[model samples]
Target: MPSMHRKRNKSLGLLELIAIALGGMIGGGIFSVLGISVSMVGVFTPIAFVLGGLLALLAAYSYVKLALYYRDEGATYSFYKKTFPKSRLVASIVGWWVTFGYISTLALYAYTFASYAISGFEFANSEIARKAVAGLIIFIFTLINVWSVKGMGKIEDLMVYTKLIILVIISFVLINNSNTTIPKILHNHEDINILSIVIVASLTFVAYEGFQLVINAVKEMENPRKNIPRAIYSSIFITTLVYAIISIGAILAIPFENIIQNQEYALASGAGEVLGNIGAELVIIGALLATSSAISGTLFGSSRLISVIANDGYFPKFLTKRKNNIPVYSIITMAILTFCLILSGNLVVILEFGSVTFLLVSLLMAYTNFKIRKHTHSSLIVTLLSAIGLMSGTVAILYFEAITKVEQVYYIGGLYIILTIFAFIFSYKRN
Candidate 1:
């Protein structure tokens, strides 16, 4: 409620809150996902993003309501735990799944950061170099987070705002130099159907995953009642708009083959081919800023969630320890796990895992809101719609992975089994 600019404040204002949410949402999201989306539905990429954003917005409805009622910085896990205090097993399971989902997203962001950060170098293609940069950036942001919340917020504000300006410039330049018209592209891809677009949109749920990070900062921000909904909704709307414009520009200007071939760094590579070095470098810069701030915001918020869950006996107790109220152990532990994920998995798997994890976790959150609809003052119709939409998104994603990458479906099932075992053990101990 108070201005953070009044000489070093303890609380985050609306601007810093929006910066954190936007930072997480935009970072590595569009940059890494563009090519895959284009490959799936061609010129319908922006339409998919818009539809995916609607899913995100629908999910945000419950998040905002629960955040205000519970007012807990713990967010997803806390909401479920509080809503179903008697079901320790369910609560513990949700805790593990949601927490690890954030970890995977953090890994995805860090890995994306490394890819673009070294794109111009000869060693950029070297696996070792990319992993090293990923680890290094995670370490750097970990230090920033452990140092101070205010410091991290300030740095996030800079990166987020600067990237927005650069994205606008990139969008304008790309559209101005367009090589194809929307109608013409659509004619060529007339076979693409609504089911494919919806599936593609579900594939994009990962990009919209970070809006809930705003609720993670509830304890540090002022006026949760007002800022909570404002920050989350505003960030989602803005991020969707930015992603649409950028996707439109890329689809119209860059060749589809180029985008598909250069999947890892499509925007940067395509921009380079179109506008030469300057355009490419601009995209690389935007990618760097996006992932950097995303890494910062994800680590900052997820650590707090971890600490809270640890205190509730679902995680390692050591994670609950904090240095100067910063959850240093949780932050460092998450960074280490994230780096391990980066080392273990390739880019595509990491991205899909993050998206799938978030989709499942958000569905649970929507279910939580539906359970407490009356108490949270939520509309029955909206709650049902949110749950239905999230369920459809989840089924859509799993269907895609099942049909295309059946092995990944097994891999995801294996992960859930392992997580459920841990959740069971933790719940048993708590009982």
Candidate 2:
């Protein structure tokens, strides 16, 4: 008779890391941002996206350095713990907040998918049907995640490819239509300012959030030290180029005022103007896939967060159960919560709340980078500059919204703060 010990799964290879990075970065942001960014920056929207991409690259560099040096699964939480060992509670808070941020983002994307899907059908136009469809979409993706991580990964790969193809096709079509003039919308505008550009850039930056999801799967990466950084930078470069082209095409096709007034599906409308009805339809389908993929990837990554918290004894042990290596219970829980959020039909509010929390997490990550530089002798100059860029960009966005959309900002922030406090108390009591 012989006994054998089971071996744990190893690190992810370069291709797998690229898959994860592409899956994360090519989601709802590109699908949804054209109209909004154009409204804010006019024909300069493409420039704004490029500027945001630069900042995202800096953040990605910081994340890669942290992941390689620390070589742990906690991502930002791990960085914070190592840098601020004396403030473990703060690290825990940041970790919990990041989990909440991702979950909220998942809910937002689910709601967006539902809204778009419903719009495509007669049922979505109806209030009740819209909510029902939204819930159904959320639940279905949740189940997909619960069933198997491998299955979810395959789905994300397909989605990333589809999105990339669609973006390329649209870019080609728009560029081919050289007759389209770059509308001089900015010439007449009085609102062009640094603050406005920063706010728009921040919004554009959010589209790049998925790059870090690759790092979360670092343990699953083969030679994460080598492969992960390449994937992160490569994905960012490709996505940034795609986004800039799309934004430019959109502004060139449609006038700025029209985009502002028609904020819903602005990018698709612009594509239609450039490529006719067929191009617009393709863009819509692409947007649907983009939102669906974002929700799917968010569910996949967010469930891991819950699994981590449970493994740490911060949540019920049942939540940590991995059926076929997937956290079934946590996935189902997140799906249910996401379903409820979709039912509320408040995607914008959910997005704002998610952005606020995520920005806070980024702030903490920046601080962590600052602290860890002393230990690793990593480039302190780049780290500090990145932190400043992130914080300033986040504040600029928040400030813009606070001035013009004060009520929405207050409501979303207040709700997130309340939820954060309650979650903290619950975790502390359980401990």
Candidate 3:
């Protein structure tokens, strides 16, 4: 057992790095967002997924540049802090926002895991039962991570690759069983709003949020410069393809009403109806593995960043507590807060907040890269475009929420206010 600052042997290869990145990106993301996307864009759901991937790719440009330049495992916060070393406030704000962003995603993944786990039970729709299950899973993974680093990595590889295979199989099965065609769905939705498609695409960016997890693995990777870009770009491209095919199969095989009706367990319910019980079971297994791995990977990376922030005095010193080379306090704190969010049972609002936070942080990253383009070997044009694209995504999601879910807008706004206050308080204390 080693302490927090002890350097372990770097054993992860390129494949394992890809597994971690994919595991982080795919968890509960597609399962959670598919229904919302279809509800907004109708037959154009797959198109929105593609557009969302493009936005993610644009954001990755800045992140990869920063990762190569700094090569620090602190990720988003470290990039900002190193780029603007004099601005402790900038570092504190980025750290808080990025940490909470990961927390929201963790909560989202756990809640979705619970949704699928209990989908077949008589009390499947019981909110209380769902929250209880969510808490149980988070606690389970927290223990796994705090127990052993090697075990977590091995389990992540197994779960990530296995779930991907299941997802691909499910997509094909649904497509084979379909009674409808793409053209027919398109013709039926000919009157759908184009703006609606763009808005859904912006919101769908949340599903592509985990690619940055690769940069967080810099300390454990073989080659930071090469593997970082290879893993991220490949993961995003593969994720986009998988999501597109799944959305296509889903819409053609099942009705949109069922998807929206069973939003939490959309694929499971849809598969049950079209391909019988085994199809449904396969989907359940895939969702479970996807989210389980996501929970583990997110906890692993996020706890490290938390430790880094705490070391800088932007967070409570107690958060730097470690056991057996793991950040025990940070991991436990994230799990508890995530469980509380699960108790809130407002997955929709949580999803929106997660999206807004990532988009804003990404914009900041792009701006930081733009400011120091010469050193990072980044392009001014591409970095500027990344910022513009991310800015539009933030505005699009907020505007869409205002028009459709005004209450959610207030909820997101209030969360930002609380986070901002904590950031400044800790930052001032550090000074």
For all candidates, what are the clash counts?
0, 7, 0
lDDT of 1 by residue, 327-397 (tens): 99999999998998888887778777778888887888888998888899999898888889988988998
Query: What's the TM-score of each model vs. the native?
Result: 0.97, 0.90, 0.97
Any residue pairs clashing in model 2, and if so which?
11-220, 11-221, 11-222, 12-220, 12-221, 12-222, 13-222
Q: What is the lDDT of residue 304 in candidate 2?
A: 70
Candidate 3, TM-score vs. the true structure?
Answer: 0.97
Which model, 1 or 3, shows the larger lDDT? Answer: 1
Model 2: how far is 323 from its true place, Å? 1.5
Count: clashes, candidate 2: 7
lDDT winner between candidates 1 and 2 = 1
The parts of candidate 1 lying over 4 Å away from their true place are 1-10
Q: What is the C-alpha lDDT of each candidate?
A: 0.89, 0.70, 0.88
What is the full ranking by lDDT, best candidate first? Answer: 1, 3, 2
Span of ten consecutive residues with least summed lDDT in model 1: 1-10
Shift in Å, residue 223, candidate 1: 1.0
Candidate 3 has an lDDT of 0.88
Report the CA-based lDDT of candidate 2 relative to the real structure: 0.70
Give the top-scoring candidate (lDDT). Answer: 1
